[model samples]
Target: MTTTSTDLDAEALDLLRALTGRADAVFHDGQLEAIRALVDDRRRALVVQRTGWGKSAVYFIATLLIRRRGAGPTLLVSPLLALMRDQVAAAARAGVRAAAVNSANAHEWGDVQRQIAQGQVDVLLVSPERLNNPRFRDEQMPELMRTMGMLVVDEAHCISDWGHDFRPDYRRLAELIRTLPGEIPVLATTATANERVVADVEEQLGSGTPVLTIRGSLARASLRLGVLTLPTSRERLGWLLSHLVSLPGSGIIYTLTVSAADDTARLLREAGHEVAAYSGRTDPEEREVLEQRLKTNDLKALVATSALGMGFDKPDLGFVVHLGAPSSPVAYYQQIGRAGRATDNADVLLLPGREDADIWQYFATASMPSESRAKAVLAELSGTPLSTPALEARVDLKRTPLELMLKVLDVDGAVQKVQGGWVSTGLAWRYDRERYERIAAARVAEQDSMLRYESATTCRMQLLQADLDDPAAAPCGRCDICAGVWYPTDVASEAAGRATTALDRVGVEVEPRAQWPAGADRAGVSLTGKIPPEERVESGRALARLTDLGWGTTLREVFAAGSPDAPLSRGLLDGCVRVLKEWPWAERPTAVVAMPSTSHPELVSSLAEALSSVGRLTLLPPLTATGPGSTTGRARGGANSVYRLADVWQAFEVSPSLAEALAGQSGPVLLVDDLVDSRWSLTVAGRALRRAGAPAVLPFALALVG
Candidate 1:
């Protein structure tokens, strides 16, 4: 039976005081009413309020009130590990016992499970992926679904494919919600959802019951918004250096990619500012330390990708500067919302880059799973469970994309991740082609919105507010548009030069393939386990990664569609010479050989000739393409190790003349190629050269695409 005004208002106030550590404290607008909706009416609710608006308070208070009446613990499906950490800490302050299970605390899982079973934890915080854990799903979830007092879905916007950040695992919540007991209240919360996203999330939360949505103004009055259009990374870095100290308390510097974040952090550290890179590549343990460092103002800033966004909270974070704009205005709002939650003023600036769209396009395409790929994955599944690697051997998709597709399929009931691996559920599924097309079109629209945000002069804050469909979308008089560029607009020449020099210094080490991909034997390739050192290429070098801050622009142009394959540019040749000069190889090359490259034969041959001429080494005849599908020296669209290796196996061979030449030489052979994607081509080519009697092979490339 519903509580229906059980009369806990005084106790709720006492709990709020205990939470705030103030003798006299009260609830924010709609907070008390939302609490009543949960504790009294036991209804599903969604609270969309700005960051620091105390959304957590409503749930925490509701949980406490409900528990006082002898209810089970609240299960929170949070989005990030940092969020789990923060939630656990906040629960402690409110005197509510909390426990979290995430990738960072795997060792404590048994303890957490035990505590949950013993009813020692009042609230449980978990990543959305935790819902799909085989053991938990089979053993613990059924019981939790029955007994859970309340369910809280934080960052609920992620549940909607229409949201800027759509998470497949979060889709699993629909099943959980559909199965949950009707009496148990549900709460969904997000600060970043626009109207469409809100409607989607609201529908999901309702399941069958009606959902109560409480939306507050999305505006952050304290943020002074601005955009600075920079032509190059060097100038952007220069601007950051000139103004970082002048900005408010320690904050986050956002970048679009992991390499960009790392590159920015390196340059900043070299400039003597205390900063560190935080991205998806960062270790979970290390990420915790970095989050604390930022909260405590121990570092000037953390250069980060979107991984560091969401649930991270520092009441006094005084600034958020984007090195490049996010693909969507909503995502940008969520990121910048991390700053100025408690303070009266904060600075929010955007440094738009020419490379932003390219990066955006890459992510946009990569995130969408194709219907053909889905069909391929389903065809490979069987009644028997198959681990991801075992499944990869039979499919052409890469590991990441494959796993993502499986997650989507899992939510759709086509497959399930069991204890051993994934198994087909024999459930009929249809690809929602029209829905996906709609989502794709929405993504394009959002991208265009970001473009407008960059160039808009009509109050940046108001524009973001309007994008989120906030009722309070009035203009702020402090934006760059309204105030005539309040922040620094010029970069220091010295700082720009330093950044340029650092980024210009190129040559990333390309580690050789250590092992053949699994399923190679099935593909008619005998390679397995570790590649023998005798047939392996020595550690190689590339002029730059296509994503790097330096030479990447030039490399992108050279590989872009419609770009002609020509001889190495003068700048590329000079870069090659510099890379070789500092390569620190074990031995100098005695011979230079070019890899077969129909698409870039001129580029490869010119690079090989340049290296040979500069080092005064013998220029042997280039390798020849052979075997089926070998007419094109480039790979045959291989997406995984097994497939890539099969395409390249026996694809390149040394001629009788070249074999004889290699047999007589003792020093390492410098093998040149235009690009390296899967590294299988280089590995196969190097093995052939080694078998033909080259002592060692040194693989070099103009760019590394993977």
Candidate 2:
């Protein structure tokens, strides 16, 4: 019972009226009519939509129309197997015969082929990987495509390497679609895209075919964006737990790495929070577990990498937290859109820090190749498939960097992933390994540029929007810096009263002296206290003196103590800054101790060599106890225990305030101990110092002071 265009138009109107309660509602917009004309004129077409837009409706409505006229069927090629299944389920609920081909069953491919050949399946859904099967082309796919009225490519941005979700299999799709008769009317759609992705889709699929660009402005007015920079990830985790405790509803926490996602989930679970995690590495069973849990609201929050956000929509989400920076603006928008779907007033929190920039640089260097390197890899594999070993040998590069180069090539459509190997995509691009390295380096340089943009000191939002070509965007007044902007105020009365306090805080310059300035009273001052003998009081004084001198670099070193190893440990360094910032002013020492690692001949020699290249203040490993006379345990049976103190000092580098307490006292040696059993070693050491007419000797326990 074949029919014509007029018959299809009638059936489409009826189907629309059934869905929306009005017959004429189907074609009221020119968009639908324009899509129909592609089939009417026998031309392939490309359709792109922004997120929250109804691009799916365009194809589904047209499918109803064409099916009524007895067109064979419409087939949807999707990249996400889970999403494909979900879509099929939705179509079936609407009484449409839709089924998806998936890897879940060994017989799915054969079953799909049988169903398609017998005309039992009205709408067939398959992933791009499935399309690469030889059976798809060797059989009657050409006939099936000709009979089909529309060939839909969902989430079309997957074809673009510049897109957040780049799929290598999508590059082969252009060849597959071209094999179909009259080049089946192709409709590709997604919720997100920049100019680059949109162009890639048209060039790859429609190939100059009519492109209907239906742009939608679906900005949710109730959403608020905020950013917080913290000193450590642990502190950020604490803040996250606090946010979750107060906010009710489902939330998504986006992490940059798999370890972060797993660790966050475990940490949240230990805190009595129900959380699920998703990533590319999740096993099939685990993915099923999480998917079911998420759908039923059994999980209150989901900590996931970007891999989880494609088609899982749970409209009740309350917020999105970016634990790391997204790769690009498109990615950021898509991840954040997961929230506020079924609720109003959704909020997004971005926690940015210096660490994120460095992490991104690491990724940029490791994951992507220089453009020239990518080109060179493609050149080596030109005209034939090559195993990884052969490719590596031909490229003459190490396995890891070479593998990464191939991946970047796959993303760029210059190569294709075949079974157990890869082959050039016949794109005619050529380059050597050197060129690829150069290109990869250039890409990293671009990422550095983006880091600079994020750290800009002014107009963050304006700069971001302008980069995206959205200049009309207004300043988000709720941002941290914007909220703190100040205006003139009538505070002359209050200002006069605080002049002395301000002056005291700024301090005064004086010649090096032993005591505080004459007028600077020590009443209520906590800084001047007795100091310990063995403790390095000069190191603490040097730290304070450096701070007084406004040397920002010394703040991290003097207060923050690290083992000679792990110099970049942010926890230890920031903790050091915390101690110095809290030091009381009256405790200032004129002659500070310089216990710089230089005091140790062995350690200083290594440090000197490293400093020649890395600059001063090299963090080195602890000096292990060895040699016949080396002290490993408590000094002199624990009395005035320098061993325990030295160990703690070596590991944590904490300088007890007891050192500062004993400052400026010209007397016998003073000692600080956590515990002591005997007085022999302390008496002997004290006597030896006094025999030499040293300053007075005293002993104090850190535990007692603590």
Give me the candidate number with maximum TM-score.
Answer: 1
What clash count does candidate 1 reach?
Answer: 0
Candidate 1, residue 368: the lDDT equals 70
Model 1 lDDT per residue over 1-706, tens place: 3343535787788899999999888888989989988888889999999999999988999899988888999999999889888999999999999998777777888898789878897898988898888877787777677668999999999899887775899988977888777889999999998899899988888986899899999888889999999898889989998889999988999999888898889998999999999999999889999999999999999999999989998989999999989999999999999999989999999999898898888788676778888888888886578999999998877788888899999999999999889888989989988888898899899999999999996989899999999988888888999888989898998888988888798898989999887788988898679999899999999998888877887898898867898888899999989999999999998999998876777888999998899889999999998865333324534377787777778788799999999998989999999888778888889999999999999999999884
C-alpha lDDT (0 to 100) for residue 686 of candidate 1: 95
Off by over 4 Å in 2: 1-44, 135-146, 177-180, 365-429, 432-706
List lDDT for all candidates, in order.
0.88, 0.52
The number of the candidate with the highest lDDT is 1
Q: Pairing residues by index, what is the TM-score of model 2? A: 0.59
